[model samples]
Target: MLLPNSKRILLKLSGEVLMGEQQFGINQETVAELAREVKAAKDTGLEICLVIGGGNIFRGMAGAAKGMDRAQADYMGMLATVMNALAMQNALENLGVHTRVQSAIQMDAVCEPVIRRRAERHMEKGRIVIFAAGVGAPYFTTDSGAALRAAEMQCGALLKGTSVDGVYDSDPKKNPDAKRFDTVTYDKVLADNLKVMDASAVALCRDNEIPIVVFSIREKGNLARVLAGEGVQTIVQGNK
Candidate 1:
């Protein structure tokens, strides 16, 4: 189902998607294409907020597993997200789309601090706001940061653009017969460990009454199509 009058929405992207077909790191060509897709959505008169993950460059949990200090590793991961936000900002600006990178971690030389009112003003002036650094804290994932920003911004919905077309009962990659859901309850996602997102992120959206729309970002023009309610996607909401 289409979101009810989605004037403003949060678009959450995984950093791995920026890697394109490569094994690691940001791929410039891929970022440009994604920027075009975002611009198209913005041109549709929708205000956009973006939150990108840092797994493409570094994953804090992976570092912690390898014996690095969890907090320090997480900080490194946060910086990686800033790099991504800057790349996206550059790409969008090249396309003549006004964009701002508001980071949770203070970095005045590169981007603005995460000020809710300022971000709201930026959106009002037609600039896309990209939030970085995952709530500026260790332990919390970008998914959690996205949920927080979605709530703070009072976004109509949270659009999770991933490589997969939608949420499935199991890992579609591992299980060829995995069943995809057109609609799902937040509780079911949590109870089933569906992995639509982390448990905390799902709970935040559920508590705030924000719908989460999951769709494939790899598909060309899919973001716009999903926003139009004409693309393959899974909507996660509270039980009716």
Candidate 2:
């Protein structure tokens, strides 16, 4: 089955997903499993794009506590995303998924620079374009960068694959009584202070009319299920 009303989707996966059960670093098995799910989604005829976070390897804010400059740490974090992107590229290609890694910052020897037209061409050709490096700047999370890319790529929706199934009234793990929403309006998310994405990212999605599908990546094949509207997820889009 196809993702109803969606021809293209931008998937935002955190670096931690690549780490599997490990404390840090890429886990080969996890990446392979994720690639399979992505391939399934692709098989549904959706042109896919990826925007991966770098928290598994490094978080600029965390590095700053270790006496590293914020910009320096952020640059390091950006590089970490590229590493994750490279790992994903390898995994997807191994499965014959046909993938390309495009970094926001130009590093031609390592990967292609973020070129809008070229990226669009890749997607049209059914190649998964993995976007990395977080806007190629500091003081911004990959969430915002992902939103930007989703808008630029003209994707139908932004699928945020996280550890939790959906946006909750409170931290679900911390509060057993927390309520989960099947869907939420942009205003409700901001007014209720829901932890979907950062303010800038959420705002970008709202302004661009791009729906954000928040679902757990930990569940086996949940990404494909969510797209088919058969999995637990929260859709943050328009209206109250």
Q: In terms of lDDT, which candidate is strongest?
A: 1
Q: Pick the candidate with the highest TM-score.
A: 1
Report every candidate's CA lDDT: 0.96, 0.93
TM-score of each: 0.99, 0.97
Q: Which portions of model 2 miss their true places by more than 4 Å?
A: 1-3
Candidate 2 lDDT, 1-240, residue by residue in tens: 324767889999998999999999999999999999999999988999999999999988899889999999999999999999999999999999998999998899989999989999999999999999999989888999999999999998999999999999999999999999998999888888897999989999999999999999999989888988899999999985
Which 10 consecutive residues of model 1 have the lowest summed lDDT? 1-10
Q: On a 0 to 1 TM-score scale, where does candidate 2 land against the true structure?
A: 0.97
Model 1 score (lDDT): 0.96
